[model samples]
Target: MTRDATSFDALYKAEPDPWNYETSAYEAEKYRRCLALLPRCRYPRGLEIGCSIGVMSAEIAQRCDSLLALDFAQTAVARARARGIPNARFEVATIPAEWPAGRWDLIVLSEVLYYLGPAELDRTVTLVAKSLAAGGCCLVAGYTGPTETTLSALDVQDRLLHGLAEAHPRHAIYKDRDASWIAAIFECRTCPAGG
Candidate 1:
């Protein structure tokens, strides 16, 4: 089953930085590598899923004209909003259910997809493919470590790639993997100039 919002809310209530997003050297490196994997230097519109407290959102916002960051937990959203990222907006939202309307030039899924059940994961893949602009890109970063969630990171990646293949034609432009994590970028081929 997908991890529910209440659990995440409780986690944030108990610890503002449950994942140590701000101070962890590992996470810092992961963010750097993930950002480096993006195909383009800038995106006009970007969406970040599961942006817990805007740590990564802050980095992503630097490369986007406008960024909308979402988290399932309201407490997390509040913290993210407090970051005061001028070009980024933080909102409380549950994925595969309450996605925002409109296409995005960049979509980021960072260490979050493995929490979803099979059905929800499939729905999210469809949403991502359909909402991505013709020349947009999707960046997926996952923890390769063992987990108690509905899917493993590698499993989520495989399912996402397969589902995307069925929904749209995209190029897997970049990929990086190590013992602890994996990251990849998929870019749409039909984008017009400057898209």
Candidate 2:
């Protein structure tokens, strides 16, 4: 079965922060790398999918004027909203089903892709490609490889459409090796004249 938004809802229902934001070394370094590699220094509106308990959202909040952090479970949403994370607006919503209309300057899919199967992931990539504003960038990273749990590494999975390359003919990919796992960066396609 594909890991849809429901998979995360059930996951978050069991634990508000399934990834252990406060104590996990892996999550800390991953968020650090994500922010440093961003194409822009500032974004007006950002979107973070599968925000869990909003740890990553708090970090992302530093770079954007406003952030829309989303999780599938109400339990996660309640805690995320209560975290009083700066410049953040928390909402409980499912992926693809509850995506905001128009465009975004930044989108973070950190560690959330593995739960989804190929088809849904492809649809997500399509959405990412279309939803991005001109010159905007989307950062897609996941737990590099498999774990004892249901998590699948974004590195090994072919389910996601974009190849794990920092610089494709159309875009770029940079894989950073950390103590725990590798973080991959995928930039969007640039147009002829500019962004």
Which candidate number maximizes TM-score?
Answer: 1
- The lDDT for every candidate, in the order shown, is 0.89, 0.71
- The alpha-carbon deviation from the true structure for residue 99 of candidate 1, after best TM-score superposition, in angstroms, is 1.1
Native-referenced Cα lDDT, model 2: 0.71
- Residues 52-87, model 2: lDDT tens digits: 888888988989999999877777778889889768
Error of 1 at 25 (Å): 0.7
Candidate 1, residue 148: the lDDT equals: 72
**Where does candidate 2 clash, by residue pair?**
165-173, 166-172, 166-173, 166-174, 167-172, 167-173, 168-171
134: Cα error in model 2, Å: 1.0
Clashes of each: 0, 7
Point out where model 2 deviates above 4 Å: 1-14, 148-151, 155-170, 189-195
Candidate 1 on 118-154: residue-level lDDT in tens?
8889899989988988888888889987677868888
| Candidate 2 TM-score to native | 0.80
